[model samples]
Target: MVFAPGEKPGLEQDEVKLQKASKQIVQTAILRALQQVSQESQQRQAPPKGGPSLQLERGKLTKKHEKK
Candidate 1:
């Protein structure tokens, strides 16, 4: 149970390493969650069923905004 005065303890070093590893793991998980949420938000913001699906009356819309 005794380590030389100047020598580092393996158990303590291992615990420090594990702490760093866990922090990295948590950070990566948070990054992934944020990315997924952004993707879902973008998908929801996209036009439904892709492209314009408007069924405006023939004279309802002005020529200024036509999809042509």
Candidate 2:
């Protein structure tokens, strides 16, 4: 689109294609993370009043949250 008369239009087409691809990649990463957290919450039960399993599950949740 920026070309003068007689110049090739290939570079302009490449720029537009690159911009769309970049946006698609970023949005896909965000949605995948959201899906993981929701899935984890569904599979887990409430922690025992107090025990090692409770502590370990809580620690795992914290680590997964930190990863994002």
Candidate 3:
């Protein structure tokens, strides 16, 4: 493609602008994904609330039937 001398600079500037915009878009997407993963990991690390507590009793395994 033969571009006129006056149009060459404009085309170059447009190409640079497009490259910068695309880079910014990709960076933003990556940042958002990282943040989401960090949040999910934090949630998983948190302990459950109002759940059954586990304990180890040091005695024989005998079941005492309770009168209900």
| Best-matching candidate per lDDT | 1
Where is model 3 poorest over a 10-residue stretch in terms of lDDT? 47-56
| Residue pairs in candidate 3 whose N, alpha carbon or C atoms collide under 3 angstroms | none
> Candidate 2 lDDT (Cα, whole model)?
0.67
Clashing pairs in 2: none
Residues 1-68 of candidate 2 have per-residue lDDT tens digits of 47788678797788899999999999999999899988767545654443333234644633223222
* Reference-based TM-score, model 3: 0.58
* Error at 44, model 3, angstroms: 0.6
Model 2 poorest 10 in a row by lDDT: 59-68
On lDDT, the stronger of 1 and 2 is 1
Task: Specify the poorest-scoring 10-residue window by lDDT in model 1.
Answer: 55-64
Residue-level lDDT for 64 in candidate 3: 35
Per-model TM against the reference: 0.58, 0.51, 0.58
Runs in model 2 lying further than 4 Å from the true structure:
1-8, 45-68
Backbone clashes for every candidate come to 0, 0, 0
The residue pairs in collision within model 1 are: none
Off by over 4 Å in 1: 1-8, 48-68
List model 1 lDDT by residue over 1-68, tens digit each: 78878767687888899999999999999999999999867765763664554433575843224455
